[model samples]
Target: MQKTNELSNLTKWLDQFPLFHSGDEVDEVRQKVGHIFVPHNLNVIGQEQHLSADMNHLNLENTSVNTLKYGAGVKITCDPFEKFLLIMLPMTGVMDAEVENGRVKACNDVAALINTSDPLSMNWGEHCNQLIIRVNKSLIERTCETLLGHPIKEDVKFASALDMSKGHNIYQSVIHMLATNPFLAESAKLYPLITKQLEHLLASSLLLNQQNQYTQKLLNPEKIITPLYIKKAEEYMNEKASEAITLQDVANNVGISLKTLHNGFQKYRNDTPKNYLKNLRLELVRKDLIAAKLEKSNTTVTEIALRWGFIHLSHFSESYFNKFGEYPSATLKN
Candidate 1:
């Protein structure tokens, strides 16, 4: 059957489920599936829901599953021991996910792998659509163990998110495989391929998470200030001096406390963060001034300074002389 047709059929089945019509009864249904008590409404149409013989296994009818409506928003509270991973591919709109520590915004073409055991909330905006798959944790772990040729750690969670662009491609491929090769879905022989893809997706997410985390650390001081963190912060300051920025903004981005950030920068650069940022701004202004000297030939010192976040002309002039051994006007004259 065509993928759309299959999904449509699945959606039909889900709509027929008693839980869909029973307003608050969906909570009971979810709780029975090992989720903690929470009030949320599910408006599913078509064959969006499916279950295998095993209670833990489920095949989300991708075709018939059109809109997975979350009445009070996409706030799903999971039981700690549920041991299920939810793979969600948002077809349209964006999803804002809030966890204990942080939040991330996920949009179309991206896949979010939510650990149902974790206390997290998802906010799905209007016009949003998605394909959701619920997989048993044991099944995934066993698949990973067999693929890696060893026992995988149970506690180490894969990235709870995946890049939509890459995920969309993978989702399409999976759907194609499942639709064209029904036997593969039935026999569980496709576990190897699934495992490999899952591993790759998780790895990608981890790398992205680390990169973002590292970036946040670099921009904030309360976080660890490694050499790389300092380097990245310096680079970012240099690149974004023209934009409206502040030390607090930098610190927040780096995920560090303000005091710790100052100390780290002082230790590494031997200068205060404000002073360092000022110098960077001055450097960019200097470059612009030098270029203007050749091009416009009449760009004033105040013009260049103000253009680069130097609000006070006297301070700008003093800093300019200290760094380059010449006042702004002197540079223009030379």
Candidate 2:
């Protein structure tokens, strides 16, 4: 499913990872590189005249993760991501990087934690292929608040470093999902049901293990994300998804705070309430398209989309594609 007009600006094809080939165009390559991950100037190194940048990426709001390959030697420079944080590692090839205060040796045995709001730089070795996870700064910070059961007056800043050898299990879980499973496990993108689970789980893991101001609080097992509360929230959203219901509205209806609602969903569904509602709306819209097609009705894509509260046509279409791997009109074609 390709991104519809509404979602094309910020999403990839529903089932595609949005691959790109730079054809030695450094500036052009940098733009795509910058758009999905962060702004960076990529320069080919030492006799590497024919530099080609290949990349495949996805945007999970809080987790805009991707894999990039610059077919030869190159160096990348960038400022901190304004509102995001990054977790980067090499899936293949060696990288000698100095980010913030940590130095990844030539052996490339460790991952780099980057504060997108802090200045950072790195150099990529020839033949290096890397996996970069870019997550929204606010989302991670909010997760801390949920864990601690209180509002945070200060922004959460993670340590500028991580030793991958220490949290091997969590890192391995992320890698396994990226390499195989319902998320990036196969050639096609998983639907929202699975995609959200993977993203929430992996993103949560990053906040949980990576050294941060809220590490101890997040690690506490005492927080009660009552499953009953989660179900109540889910039920309310499922019933009102087509009625312009926001996360707050659902949270209120469920007798829980918005933050607690988020925590509950994260614990039980491995998803955020907003995403879970969006998923339901997407599924309903798809169903309507299929029904209209079967009945040979006069319904248009806009009608069906709007009925489901997807007023932003292009984003809705892209989101539809993101879930169904095809456009709504295609599904309803006469």
Candidate 3:
């Protein structure tokens, strides 16, 4: 009953958005949805009934959120999703899927993460309505590389089942925010900074939270003894924190490979070098914001953030909130 009510509420919440696709015709609905996602074999099953399908989609730069329902039982099969990863959360009824990991019946508490290049199939219950998050393949790979401080040769493979009961509600919250937030509605047009950060957030969240090929390595990055050169690298980073520097630049200055620099930071600082530099810049931004607040200065957050090498305001604001438990504007105000 509780799950049903929650799904009902979510359905209502999603209905506020204009429909992106809907129809009672099988071929038309299938083709429309295929264009939005990918071409797939969508077949009606069990009954010879007129099709009833509807979809609501929101597209971002590197990620998209979609709510889909085929008001009749349907079986869908497709080749590997070669370009993106799909996270499927069934809002009502069951969705049985066969992916690389194995077969799983996704329902209220169970979600699906599909990323492998293996052919897969799914059977959606007649009343099934699902919320799907599509993230770009290259985005995930790039985020993984940033975390490992090196390029990955193989694709990131995620376990098919996502146990949403175990604190995975963050995805829904983010989706809800995207759907309802007025600023976000116009973010892509007027707030590229926000979209960039949101892109990073989604990519990072998937890599950090989902069970993937790099899970163990990411959790326990090889703990080597911190070397003197690692300390020197930190010093170099501190001195150059205000400059637009890349991981390669830091490694080059320390006369070490990116992998070696990552190992040192992981072992000694319990973080990736990329994050270390970000936190350093965030601290500088906060300090400056606090001073501005005290002096009643008219300097904008954008100016201070850009001065400290943060190009994306939304990303900077999100990072500021994560670090200080408040937005940069709040810091500037109070």
Candidate that scores best on lDDT:
3
Q: State the TM-score for model 1.
A: 0.38
Model 3 lDDT per residue over 1-334, tens place: 1253375464555555546545788778878888877789988987746457878876775677678888889999988987788888787878999987789889887878888485789999887888787877767876887786555668899878877663544555554455345455466767756886877776776677778889888877775566788789879989999888899999999899999988877767657889888878887997899799779989999999999998888888888775554578887884
Model 3 stretches astray by more than 4 angstroms: 1-8, 11-22, 166-183, 223-334
Better of 1 and 3 by TM-score: 3
Q: What is model 2's C-alpha RMSD?
A: 10.3
Query: TM-score of each candidate?
Result: 0.38, 0.57, 0.64
Candidate 2 local Cα displacement, residue 219, angstroms: 3.7
Q: Clashes in each model (backbone N, CA, C under 3 Å)?
A: 22, 13, 0
- Write candidate 1's Cα lDDT for 227-293 as tens digits: 7666666777777789888888877776777897788776765567787788678778878877887
Question: Sort by lDDT, best first: what order?
Answer: 3, 2, 1
lDDT of 2 by residue, 1-334 (tens): 1111222222233236655855578888887777776677777886666777777776552466576777778877777776677766665666766666566543234667777566666777776666667766655655565566544555566776545543455754664455333344343233544655565666577678777777876787464555687778878888887787788888788788989887867765556778778878887987888788778888899998889898799999887664544577876872
Lowest summed lDDT window (length 10), candidate 2: 1-10
Order by TM-score, highest first = 3, 2, 1
